[model samples]
Target chain A: DVKVTQSSRYLVKRTGEKVFLECVQDMDHENMFWYRQDPGLGLRLIYFSYDVKMKEKGDIPEGYSVSREKKERFSLILESASTNQTSMYLCASRLAGVGELFFGEGSRLTVL
Target chain B: EDQVTQSPEALRLQEGESSSLNCSYTVSGLRGLFWYRQDPGKGPEFLFTLYSAGEEKEKERLKATLTKKESFLHITAPKPEDSATYLCAVQAGGDTGRRALTFGSGTRLQVQP
Candidate 1:
């Protein structure tokens, strides 16, 4: 079975502060993604990395950035946390070209 | 643009009651349709993947069927453990291929014991 681990399960940050959410996948998948889930909005992708050091912006990537320094690790960074950024963030990984995604437990961020 | 829509935002059922959840999708080219079950505060768990119309996959009491434009997840003899938010997603294939999935708003199911 594939396992995706998130560094934080819950976090609170003040407005204008920078936040970091980290994810690690044991499957060594080449594709990793960051998504924010909100009520009535479903899952909106923030950024995705197909390989180390390569990133692509998704539908909603404003105020967010990503890093893939290693194959097994992906990180999501909020340049400046805002109340609007408070939501559940999910990390997922999959094999290249495979549609099936194995997800992490998710990190709930509260920006106040 | 690739899109997915799930019907019936919420459903309540007594134990042993059966029902179906619908997922409608539109894409330039359909690669696959996926079904996932998400528990509160947890990530979505993959359930089924339908590749083409007339295809069906089953796991325990859940069965998923696919058509050209839509898919259905049928739950039979529901139990409290079966209660979760069901998510539907679509993968698009075309000249502009995408690796990320387009997810629906999801259908929240509650089974009463």
Candidate 2:
């Protein structure tokens, strides 16, 4: 089974704080994605990486950025966190051209 | 733009009851439709993938069937352990460059003992 790991399960931060969420996949998959989930809205794609040093914006990429310096590791960076940014963040990885996405446990962020 | 919608925002049933969840989608070109189970505070776990109309896939008590514009997930004799939010996602042919899926809001299921 493919394993995807998120660095944190929970975090609490104040407004204007910079936050970093990291994800790692052990299966050498070529695609990685970050999604944010809120109460009423489903998982919304924030960003995705197809290769090392490559990234692209998803539908809701505002106030978020990503880094994929290495194939197995991907990171999401929030320059300035706000109350609206507090939500559950999920990281997923998949083999190129495959239809399934293997997801990590998830990281829940709370900004006050 | 691609869109996915799930019906019955929430459902509650007895342990032995059988029920079905619906997922409707609209995309420029269909590539694949997927179902996932999401436990509270956890990321979604992939369940099944339907590539075309009339495709069906099953795992344990959960069976997923797909059509041109909709899909159905039938849960037979669900248990307390099966209580979770079921999510639906779709991959559009136009999303080859992004390699991402658009997801529905999800249906929250609770099976009472």
Candidate 3:
């Protein structure tokens, strides 16, 4: 089974703080994605990386950025956290050309 | 633009009850449709994938069926342990080479003992 690990399960930060969420996949998948799941909105893509140092904007990428310096790791950075950014964040990985995704346990962020 | 919608935002069933969840989609072209089970505070767990119409897949008490524009996940004799949110997503095909999926809001199921 593929293992996708998130650096944190729960986090709380004050408003205007910078936050970093890290994710690592052990299967060497070429595609990694970050999504925020909220009630009544499902999961909305924030960012996705297909290769090292390559990234693309998803539907809702306004306040977020991503780093993919290595093949097996993808990180999401919130430059300035706000109350609206409080939600459950998920990281998923998949092989190129495959639609199936292996997801991490998820990181829940609370900005107060 | 690709879109996915799931019916019955929430469902309540008895331990021995059987029911089905619906997923409707509209995409320029369809590559695959996927079903996932998500527990509270956890990421989704992949369940089944339907590549084309008339495709079906089963695992334990859950069976998934797909058509041209919709998919169904049938849970037979669900148990209390089966309570979770079921999510559906679609990947577009054709010139859109992107592999990212568009997901529905999901159907939350709770089976009472």
Tens digit per residue, CA lDDT, model 1, A1-112 = 9999999999999999999999999998999999999999999989898899988899999999899999999999999999999999999998887578899999999999
Residue pairs clashing, model 1: none
User: How close is every model to the real structure, measured as TM-score?
Assistant: 0.98, 0.98, 0.98
Local accuracy of candidate 1 as per-residue lDDT tens digits, B2-99: 88999999999999999999999998778889999999999999998999999999999999999998999999999999999999998888643388
Give the DockQ (2 decimals) of all models: 0.77, 0.82, 0.75
Which ten residues in a row are the worst by lDDT in model 2 chain B?
B90-99
Over B14-33, each residue of candidate 2 has an lDDT whose tens digit, in order, gives 99999999999998788889
For candidate 3, the TM-score of chain A alone relative to the native chain A? 0.98
* Model 3 lDDT per residue over A1-112, tens place: 9999999999999999999999999998999999999999999999898888989889899889999999999999999999999999999999886579889999999999
Error of 2 at A98 (Å): 3.6
Clashing pairs in 2: none
Q: Give the TM-score of candidate 2.
A: 0.98
Query: Best by DockQ, which number?
Result: 2
> In model 3, how large is the Cα lDDT of residue A73?
97
